[model samples]
Target: MTMPTSLCPYRMQVHHIKQETPDVWTLSLFCHDAWPYEAGQHALVSIRNSADTLRAYTISSTPGVSPFITLTVRRINGGAGSQWLTREVKRGDYLWLSAPQGDFTCAAHPAGRYLLLAAGCGVTPIMSMRRWLAKYSPMTDVEVIYCTRSPQDVIFADEWRAFPVTLFAEEGAAQGFIPGRITREHLACIPHLKDRTVMACGPAPWMEFVEEQVKSLGVTRFWKEKFFTPSAAPATSGLKISTLQPVREFYAPVGATLLEAMESNKVAVNAACRAGVCGCCKTKVASGDYTVSSTATLTEQEIADGYVLACSCHPKSDLVLA
Candidate 1:
C-alpha cells in the first residue's frame, strides 16, 4: 500500500538481531529520531529492497527507553513478511517505518489491573506493555497467560518470569506450564478475573477462544487490536474508481476493499494497519458512495466531509477521488 508523505517513514538502522526461539527472532533497530510511541502500538515497516511491501510489526521495546526499538518476529513457513524479517535482513541494514500508530495501548490508563494473554509471537506487543507497566505502574496488579508449542519454543522464556504467568502448551511438558490450550479452568484460576481488563493477541482461533472464555467469566473490559487485511475475488461486473491528483483510474470488484482495488491497480495510497484501525489510508471521496465496516479512526465530521478509510470501505458506486 502507498504511504503518505507526511507519514512517509523514519529511516533507522538495524542495530542488532537475536534468535529468540527456533523460529522467532528479534530485530533491534537504532532510533535516530526521538520517535515517540505507546507500548502496545505497532509501526508499518518496509525495507528499501521492497519499498512498496510494508508490514506491521509491534514495537516490543518501551518508549521510556531511547535510541532503540525492538520487533520480535515469528517465522511463518509461507509468510513473505515474517520470513524476510527473520532470515533475509542483516545487521546495519536500514528499514523505513511509519511513525508508531495504533490504539491498542494501555499507557494512558496505567493504574488499572490487567490480564495479558498471548500465544506465539503475539507476545511481542505484550512484552512492551509488561515492560512499561513494570517501569511506571510498578504496583499495578497484572497476570499473564502465555502459550506456545512447547517449552523449547516459548518466546522471551526468562523475561516473562518476572510477572505472574500461567504457561499453556499444546505439546511437551514443563513443571509450571500446563499441557493444553487456554480453557475456562485457567480463567477461573486467576484471582479477581472479572475485574481485570483482558488483552489478548494471537491466531484468530486462539483469540476467538480467549474472547469467548473471558466474556463467559464476566469480563467486559476486553481489548485486542488485530491487523486483518481482508481479501476477496474482484466481481465479474467490475466497478471503476478514479484518483484525483493525477486522475488515475482503475476497476475494483464490487465487494472488494477500495484500498485493495487501488493497490492492485498500482494507485499510490498509504495504508498502515490494513484493518482500518490506523487512519493512514484516509482519502477524500470527491463524488461517490461506499460502505464501511467500522467508523474506526474517522470522526463523524470527517465522514460528512467525504473522507473515507480506503481499507475498510467497499465501493457502492463508481468513486471519484478528491
Candidate 2:
C-alpha cells in the first residue's frame, strides 16, 4: 500500500457496487488516473440529473490506494445521497467530483495509539483511516469501538469484526457484544482506553458525549467529526430581522449571507451558525432563488417545500421567502 503524496481529486466512474449489509452497500470507483486523499478526507460528489441538480458524498477509500476509492453507504429513510447510492448508482454510471477536501484525517498524528469510535453509518470516514493504518502503520496500536443498532446494522461488519474491534450492539445477540450506547460505564470495560488518542465520528450528540467523557478522564487529545445540518443564526447579537412587503423584490451583494442579504435589504428571515452546520436557519423558498454553499443534507421534501438554510445561503437571483 502506497500513501498518496498529492491530493488527486478526479472524476471517477463507478466500476462496481456490492451490497454488504441490508442497509449498507460498497461502491468501488475507478478514474482515468488514481485519485488521492488523506484518510478520513471527503470529496464532493456532484450527481448531475437530467435537470442538473448535484449532491455530495464523502470519500471512503484508504489513502494507501491513490487511484481507487470505496464507500459504504448506509441507507437512511428519504436521504437523497444514501438512496441514490444504493438504488440508483450502478456500475458504469458517472459522477463529477471536486478535489479531495476536509481536515478529518490521520496525517497529523501517525505514531500515536488510535482509539477510533464510530456509531451507525458514521463509520465510513473512520474506515478509511483504519484501512490506511492497517497497511501503512501496522505497528501502531489501533482499537476500533463500533456501536450499531444490531449486527445487521454494522457497516463493514466482516472487515472490522475481523480486526482489533470492540463491537457494541444496542440489540440482538452476538457473543461479546456489549449492549447499549458507548457510555462512560461501557468504555470502562476496555482497559486503558482513556489513554489513547481518540478519533470519533458519529451523530453530533454521540461525538459530543464521547468528547465530554474522554475529557473528563483527563485525556485531552480528542478528534471529532460532527455531522449536522447548518444551524440558524442567533436572534441576538449582530442580527436584524424584517419582513418583505407583499409583491416586492430585494437585492443583496455578493458574498452576503442569506440572512445578511435579507437583513441588509430588509427582508425578514431566520438564521443561525452563519456557517453550514446547524439546520435551524431553514426557510421556505417562496417564489425566489438563492445559492447554497452546500446542500448540507436538506431533505428532498424540504427542497420541495422550498426550505433553504439562511445562514449558508447567498442570493443569486432576486427571491421571495418567508
lDDT of 2 by residue, 1-322 (tens): 1212122235568889988778788889877765557888766554343212233455677875534687667776655566787899989987555566666788875546888888877788888889888888888888888888887787776777557788788889488788777788766555667678888888756887888887787666898765432222332322222334465554444545665555445454443233454454576667555668756758988877878788677766656665
| Global lDDT of each candidate | 0.78, 0.67
Superposed by TM-score, candidate 2 places the C-alpha of residue 238 at a distance from the truth, in angstroms, of 18
Q: Estimate each model's TM-score.
A: 0.74, 0.68
Q: What lDDT score is found at residue 91 in candidate 2?
A: 93
- Model 1 stretches with alpha carbons more than 4 Å out: 1-6, 49-51, 65-67, 108-111, 227-271, 277-322
Distance from true location, Cα of 235 in model 2, Å: 15
Tell me how far the alpha carbon of residue 3 in candidate 1 is from the true structure, in angstroms, after superposition. 11
Q: Candidate 2 lDDT (Cα, whole model)?
A: 0.67
